[model samples]
Target chain A: MTEPAEPHAHQHESLPVAARVRRLEERVIAAGLTTDAEIDELLTRFYADAAPVNGARIVARAWTDEEYRDRLLADGSAAAAELGFGPQTSGFQLRAVANTPGRHNVIVCTLCSCYPLSLLGPSPSWYRSLAYRSQAVREPRAVLAGFGLDLPATTRIDVWDSTSEIRYLVVPVRPAGTDGLRPDELAALVTRNGLIGTAAV
Target chain B: MKFPPGSRVRARTTDPGHHTRLPRYLRGHTGEVVAVATPEPLPDDVARGVPEPRVEPVYAVRFHGADLWGCETGGHRHG
Candidate 1:
């Protein structure tokens, strides 16, 4: 017989996840447990210091400058910090894997969701899903295909399994046809998925 | 100490009752060490919320598709 329906299936359906988070933040602030200014400071810092936009910019800079790319590849922590990433304070080391003409790279944490929060912002729900964690390792090609990235079967696919000790960022090869774009403009083309190796830059 | 890049090693198939950083799928699988990341505390110990400082170097291990899955297309490798 089929198992009974979950008891909390519709209990919290009235409020979306974002709404719930907002409401909780508001209640916590109103309760005087945390000062509003302090909370605002944390929120502001999160948006500015830890976001995909920063990751995109880093990727873009590397695409344009060979020296910078070398530095980033050699010492991601220092290179990222030079750009004001300053994310290493959280104890998670950031490792960068560059995609080449013959190889592609992807990142996942199968056991637990380990992501560079201060560098790439919070992990997306889909990135942490059990399906992604399992399939990305078992059948990476198919998993990437599901994400709309169909790398040539001949191109090598490298999947980095992150742990709490370290997280990775994929540096996708620069696409053709944007020879005249400035660094900032090039960054606009880099999406979070590109940095995660699930999509092309 | 770090594993030299290109070193071939098999992930240990250990399941301590405590915590662990190695995922199950990777345990016992053979892969080539791609890069040596800076060392840090054992993730398992970190996950257990212990303040211990015991550490190990993290390595980027690249596994060939053929080594991971029996039904594979290209001989592409994944890290």
Candidate 2:
């Protein structure tokens, strides 16, 4: 195999975004502006508040109620606030997309992994990869199939490219055999991938 | 038009020196608006670290696979 081309300072092939973020964190620590404890605490709080559990809860609530579902489809951020997911400090916006028998929705930020971070916590590393960014829109059927979600060929896929500030949360179809499950139990079925439209709940 | 559902729009193709949210694959693609999204900060402003963010409307646009690829790509398998 031919050796890879030599990377230059201007080329980011040598230092990816993750490495840059880590280096920036090191500088902040080295500057003595904040301690690791504070950073860890903030990160913990962020994850706890914005994890997939929050999206699951929202989906479960929508599954159990019709009005809330309408509101969620109309204005995701406001409906999220009704369930105590208040407006984020950074003023991020969330939009909800529901899956129906005729259509399936998927999301991707091909520009740089711009996600519903306030609702979904940190995006998965897979979501940030260039493969996902470009292919999610170009070949959504194959991408979803790789994620273990085998939708029939009849289903029309609508790939939502988030090329702006609006972030999307997918409302996966409520699976069968869940007739007696409570809302929280139903929530337990929803995964981050489900909310991202890569997997079904 | 405000890009209401089913409204036709063409993605503007322009590579600038500043940060942008428009992806390369979608630069010249044509799509139809599916929904009107909440306004939020422009990606370039967010990247520049503006203290007060300027908000803009975001629309969910859907492009047809056949229109994008110029062929019937149904049975095409991906690697």
Which structure among the candidates has the greatest DockQ?
1
Cα lDDT of model 2 by residue, A112-191, tens digit: 66688777778776777777766777788888887878788888787766654567899999999998999999999998
In model 2, what is the error at residue A110, expressed in angstroms?
1.1
Off by over 4 Å in 1: A1-37, A88-90, B49-51, B73-79
Query: What is the C-alpha lDDT profile of model 1 across B1-79, one tens digit per residue?
Result: 5569988988888877886766666678888887777777776777788888578777777676676677654333333
Clashing pairs in 2: none
- Local distance difference test scores for all models: 0.75, 0.75
TM-score of chain B of each: 0.77, 0.74
In angstroms, give how far residue A118 of model 1 lies from its true place: 2.8
lDDT of 1: 0.75
Indicate the worst ten consecutive residues by lDDT in candidate 1 chain A.
Answer: A1-10
Clashes of each: 5, 0
